[model samples]
Each structure stands twice: as structure tokens, then as C-alpha cells.
Target: MTPIGNLKPTIKIYDTTLRDGTQGEGVSLSADDKVKIALRLDKMGFHYIEGGWPGSNPKDMEFFDRIKKHQLKNAVITAFGSTCRPGVEPGQDANLKCLLDSGVKLATIFGKSWDFHVTKALNTTLEENLRMVEESVAFLKGNGLRVFFDAEHFFDGFKANEEYALAVLRAAVLGGAEAVILCDTNGGSMPFEIQQAVEQVAAELPGVELGIHAHNDSEMAVANSIMAVQAGVTQVQGTVNGLGERCGNANLCSIVPNLALKLGYTTIPRDNLSFLTELSRFVYEITNLNPVANQPFVGESAFAHKGGIHVSALMKEPGTYEHMDPASVGNVRRVLMSELSGLSNLLYKYKGLNLDKTSPEGRKVLEQLKKMEHKGYQFEAAEGSLELMLRKAMNGYREPFQLQSMRLILEVREQQPIHSEAVIKMRVGEEIVHTAAEGNGPVNALDNALRKALETIYPEVAALRLLDYKVRVLEEKAGTEAQVRVLIETGNGKETWGTVGVSTNIIEASWQALADSMAYGLLGEK
Candidate 1:
């Protein structure tokens, strides 16, 4: 085996989330969003942030101009682009000129390293392609910007024509490129191929810095990246949450932890690793993408356990089921309660309630849990509702408000829109309040009326807002008469909680979920 001791102890993290990440389908960000994300990445200690291709669009150019106004503490903002065109000089090429004008200290430009791309894609001669790569780096370096050359398709090119691939990197180094990044552009290379190619490049290039940029088409991007690192790469270029074209780029979320925790390589500051999960979720939210619950390291279900034997073993010794402490990556271990749960799951879940598993009250709560789940209640997501049930059972909890009466009215006329209104009466302490509100739908009307009635007595309820509302048909075969389960996600700015209700009547089910959502939010205040 090649000696692993020669590998760089400190790896630099280069984030292209604002550029390559936006190439992923359905991922879009405003210049403001890019600046916000850059600030966060800088605060989190990323070494470099690739803003975008300033030559491609007005938005990216605007991003470059906007980002200059802010002071980033750690990361150097990088502008990305392609090398000079087939026949154009680096100083005259529009793309290269755009990079020069992007007002960033660093610039990364990708040039086709594969001989086939030069002959077919660019319809240019091999010598011209090599000149473009070299001259582009020279021009940028001469202009006071630090330059990094991306050898696009380097791995595949190396496999096809090893000599020419190495020559391309040699040209970049000769042009004073700070780093030559090897790219698996097609994302189809195996880990062993990556390691061998990267190692060969390191040997041939001697003291020149090397970086790795792997895509995830074959689901091997993360593996390929790690292999390259072992083969001698100091800089790792990736997008947060692995967002990129096609399948995606290598996920820094997974790569950083794997390097720091497993391989003993230092990437970001050790303390910054705990912000990984928060950063992952923030990206998903900004891009309007649903988070992958089971995604490794930073996902919601990454540390959740529900199996009885697993929970028993986990409670005894966390290492029996966990690889590392969840807190290490800013995540918490969750003991999920479900039909798959045993007494061990219950005891672990209800430990805060201070109830003995053998106690009558505990047994009753457990049976109620089972019965509710049998009726299509899913507590895993709606832990807020479960907490209310447990509190009522243990402490005789009373709700802040009790609904006395409700009325709904809907109207639809020819050539007019449908209108919905809700009237509600509720008791808060010794006061009986009445309120009416109109909305676009019955659920919205009810929510508005409820909020209007409770805000006077419990003004904190005004801060609560709906984040997500989902309905699942428990009995699909019953069609129109099916029992539907409604899950409502609510938040009070700081954090969010979920509540669920199931019934045959859709309206009743929605009411149940809505009321539980309100109840859960108020519970935090008391």
C-alpha cells in the first residue's frame, strides 16, 4: 500500500454551492441569498466560496458586485469560469474578462483536459487547448488574482490518454496556477481509478498543490473524493448538500465528517463541525427542497432509533448502535415511538416524564399510544401531540383555551370566487370570547378565527405560523369515505413542531390537527 503518512494533514474546503449547486434542477438563489450563504460559510470557516460564473448570467454578475460590500472573516470569495475560447487570447476572451471584472481575490477556471473534448467539443487542435489552459491561468495570476485550474474530465482523460492529461496539468502549473483540481466530470469513475490517477498526478507534478472535484452520477462521488484525498489532495471542492448538475456533486456534509472524524484529517475547525446539520437544512429550505430524512450525517433520521433491541442496547451503551455522538455534528439522538417500539423505546422516550415503565400510569400511556397508532396516528413526526398526551396523563395538564362553539360559512356565486368564513367562541380562564374571520379556505378561516379569539388572552399565539400541512389517506381503498390523517407543522420563529389528527371527515381531521397545533404552541409558554 502507498504510505498514507504522506497525505496532507490539513485539507481546505472549497464550497461551490452558489455556483455548481444552483445547476441542480429546481435549485435557484438570488444574489442576496448567495451573500447570506457566503456569510454563513465564512462564519463556519470554509476556506473558499465559489460565487458563480460571472460570465453566464446577470444574476451571477450581480452576486459578485453585491458580495464585495460584505466583509467575510474566513473564506476567500472565488469567481468561476471557463478558460479562453478556441482561438481567443486570454486577455481578450469575454469569459476570462468577466472573471477579471468579478472583483474577487480568487478565480477558478475549468479547461477541457480530455484530448477528445478538444478535437470534438471545441473543434480545436490539441496544442490550442493546452495553450488556452496555460494562458488563462497566466493572465489571472498576472492580474493579482490567485488562480486555480480545474482539469475538467481529468480522470476519464487520464484513463484514455495518460500522457496528455498529465501534460495539461503540467501546463497549468507552468502558468503559475495555485492548484490544479482533478475532475471526474462525467461522475462515472471508480474509487480505485480516482486514487491511481490522483497518485500518478501527485508523483508527476511533484510539489504542486492538488484538489479533487467529483460528481455523484454513479453514486461514488463521496468515495472517489476520499480516495483522491488518500492519494494526495489538499483541497476538496464540493457543494453543500451535494447540490449540482445531474446526480449532484460530492456532498461536503458527508465528506467533512468522514475526513475529520474517521481519517484524522483536519478540514474546518473542529467546533464548526457541529453546525453541519443546521447548514444542510438551511440550504434545503432556501432552495425550497424537501430535506432527505435518511441522508447520512446531517439528516433528521440519521440518529433516530425505534427497534426495541436497538433502543435497549443504545440506552445501555450508546456506542452499541451509534457510530459517534449525535452532538458531534449538531444533531440529537431521537428515540422514536411507534408500533415498532417496545417498552425500551417507551421508557427512553418518556424518561423526562419520570414515570416507571411498570407503573399503572405508564402502562396506560403505552396502551393509549398503541391504540392511537392503530388508528393511524404517526408520532414520529408529530412529537408535539405525543408530548401533550404524556403531559395530560402525568400532570393533568389543562389547555389554555377550550372551544365552546364554531360555525363555518362558504359561498360561491356565478362569475365570482368562493369565499370562506369562520365564527368561533372559546373560554379562556373566566372569559368567553367570540370572533369571526374570513379566509381563502375553510381551514384557513378556522385558523384565522381561532387566532383572533385567543390573541387577546394568549398573545404569544400570534407568533405561531403554519409551516407545512400534509394529509394522508389512511384507508385508500375506501376512496371518498376513507379515513384521512392530517399533519400540521407549526413554528413560533425559533423552532417548529408537528401535530396530527385522523378522522373520516376531512374537515374534522383538519380541525383536530389545527387545534393540536395551537395547543402545542401554547404549552411552551406555560
Candidate 2:
């Protein structure tokens, strides 16, 4: 067994989100996006940014050409490519030449480690594959570039022919490779086997910097990665959301935090680990992937509490529901006030409203919230509406504006677009204001007319703007006549909040949400 000591405690993080990551299903990144992500990783103190294989395509080539424009602060930009093909000279290989021409100080090259691949995939002799690994490493190292030799399929190869797998690492080390990385290419190996493989590789390649690259087919990529570290591998390679081929690579977001907080290993400077949520979401957004809210550490739901039991317990002690403080990784705990919410959930959620949880008024707000939720008004996603109403129920709360009446006009003609206009009348203090406006839709028109009516009374209404609006059918089987829920997101220059409304008529639902959104924005008064 390895000593499991923190001899070289600072584990190097190599992000392949730009390369191996893009191979995952439904993921794509442009040249400019790659540079942007690299810069973010650099600022967050990642050690390696594997840009992409310059030899792969024009987009990747463009990424390499463009990344040079920015001076990355911490990350070493790495060009990725495979070793020279069988019977191809390293200096003459097109892929190898591209790695040298990528203009990066670091290059990671993967070579076949499985003899099965040597015979079946490459149709080359095992000895020739050895030459490919050796010559490619020596050629890149000779070109004044630090080489990280990735032994692709090393674990599968090691399990198949331990002697041949060990030979691959030996050949790369002999060729002056700076790092030897064992890859579980198919992502099929179990964690114990991974630890065993790392241990054997460590024994053979003594004193050499070792790395582990595992995929998540068996859902053990992060587990195997940390296990590899426990077995004394000094470096780990992964992607932000575990983006890669098949199941995906080890998730650096989970791996880094696990290493830093749980295992006592070092990665990404403990201070910068707080940026994990931002980094994870940035990647998800850039890739146009829906973020996994339940993803560990950085996910939105990572620290969210929903159950009354859980929230009540968390009110007394957070550790009951949360493994770690959400803020430690830049994630905020969300206590959603829904039908599932308890007194503790309501109290925690509306603590900003300053109401006593056990007070009659407080119980009224809780009952009100439960009633609204029963009516399909989801406060969990619309705390803005919940807060405005709860505050209005309390003493000293003044109405921002009271709607007296509203009128909407819709027009349709053959070969012409539908037109919508709204006129709103509201009582603001001692004055009654009336305004009219036109919009692209009923909701927009109503929003415009209401804002026009209030902006004159409360110029602060100008500070609020509609950010997003989403409408969901309460009962899809009710079809067009189904009751709808409108969740409107509004911003007051400083922050954003969500408001909710429910009604059988979509326009009415939108109107209620719009009114609450404006009320939330105005805060105290007209």
C-alpha cells in the first residue's frame, strides 16, 4: 500500500473541458469561448488548461491561434494530440508537428497503452507502439515543450497485460516525459482497480510525476480520481462538469472540493475554490447545457431545503441537512417556501420580512403562503410576490399603488400581426393616475401601462425592469382552458427577484405577477 501521506500535497488540476470535454453529447465550444474559459480557469488558479487538439479542426486551430492574445495569469495552456502513428517519424508526423506549432509551452500527448489497441486498432506490433510513445515524447521534449504523456487505456491495458502497460510508462519516462498519466479511457474500471493500477505504476515509474484521468461510465470518476491520489498520484485531469466522451471525465468541480475539504489534499488554492460554482455554471451556460441543480458543491440545489422536516431541522442545526456550508463553495442555501415548507421554512425564507414565526400574523402569512401554493402559486420560485404580500400584511406597510381598473384592447386582421394595447388606472396616495401604452403582447402592454402609471407617482419604478417571464400550465390536460402560472423575474438595478401569479386566464395570471413584480420593486411606498 502507498503511504497515503501528503508528500506532494498540492495536487495539480488539469482541465480538459476544452478538449476531452467537447466530445460529450450535446456540448460545443467555439474558439473565442475556449479562450474565455481558459482565462477564467487561469484566474481561479488552475494549473493546466488543455486548450484542444490543434490538429483536429479549424475551430480548435483557431482557439490555439487566438489564446496567445491574452496573458493567462496562472494556467499553463496545453496543446493536446496523440502520438505519431505507426511507421510515422515523430518529426514528420502532421499531428506531432501541430503540437509543436501550437505555440504553447506545454503539450499533452496520448499514446496507446493497450496491446489490444496495438494489434486491433493500430494493427501494429507491440514494439512499434513502444517506439511511437518513446519517439513522440522525446520529440516534443526536444522541442522545448514539457510533455505530459497520457497512456490511453492504461488501466484496461494494465488489467489485460500488466507487463506491457508498465512498459508504456517506462518508455515515456525513458523519453524524458515530465509527467505520466494513466487514463481509464473507457471509464469502466472500478475504484479499487484504479488504486491498484496507480500503485503498480508508481512502483515502476518511481520518482516520476504521476497523474490519473478517469471517465464516469461507472459513476466513479471522481471517486477513482481521489482514490488515485490516496494511492499517491500527484496530479488529476478532469473537466468542469465532467464533460467528455461516453459518461464524461471526472468532474473537477467535485474532485477539487473533495480533495481540499474532505481528504486534506490541496488543489486550486483553498481560497479560489469558492469560485467553483461560478466556474461550473459558466461552463454550463457557455455550453448551452442545463445545469444539474443537484450536482454536488456548486449546484443550485446542493444546499436547498424543501421538506418541512428538513427545513425545521436545519433551522435548529444546518448540519442536519447540509454536508458543508454552501457559502464555502460560493453556493447559497435556498429555503423554498412551498406547500412542503414548514414554519421553519417560512421563517427562514421570510426572515427579511421581519415577522415572528409564532405570531398570529406570521401564522397568517404561512397560511396565506400555503393557500397560494395550493392555488398553484409557487412561492418557491416566486419569493418576490410572497414577500410583497407578506410585508403588506404587516403593520406600517403602505400600498405602493392600488389598481382601480384596467382595460386591454386586442386587434387582429387578415395578413396583419395582432396588436395589443393597455390602459391602467391606479390610485397612488391622494391622486388617481391613468396611463396607456402598446406592447408586443398582452403582458408587455400591461407592464408598460402599469409602469407608465406608476413611474410618474414613484420615479423609483423606473429603476425596475422585467428580466424574464415564464408561464406554465397548471394542468396540461386542461389544454388551452387550463389554469396557468406566470413567474416573472424583475430586477431593481441592484438585484433581481421573482414574482408569481395564477389564473385560468393567461393574461390575468401575467397581470397579477406583473403587479406584484412592480410592488416588490417599489419596496416601501408609492
What 10-residue stretch in candidate 2 is worst by lDDT?
A: 1-10
lDDT per residue for candidate 1 within 65-139, as digits (tens), equals: 998888888899999999999889988999988998898889999998899988999999999998999998999
lDDT of all predictions: 0.90, 0.89
Query: Candidate 1: deviation at residue 505, Å?
Result: 0.5
Summed over model 1, clashes come to: 0
lDDT by residue for model 2 (1-526), tens: 1223565579999999999999999998999898888999999999999999998888998998998998888889999999999999999999999988889998999999999999999999999999999999999999899999999999999999999999999999998899999899999999999988898788877899999999999999999999999898889999998999999999999999888887777688778977889999999989999999899999888998898899888988989988888887889998887777777777777776665656677677778888878888888778888887777778888877888998999999789889999988899877899889999988889989998888777888888989999989999998999999999999987899999889999988999999999888887554
lDDT of 2 at 5: 56
- For model 1, which pairs clash? none
Q: Return the top candidate by lDDT.
A: 1
Candidates' RMSD to native:
3.4, 2.6
- Model 2 clash count equals 0
> Lowest lDDT 10-mer window, candidate 1?
1-10
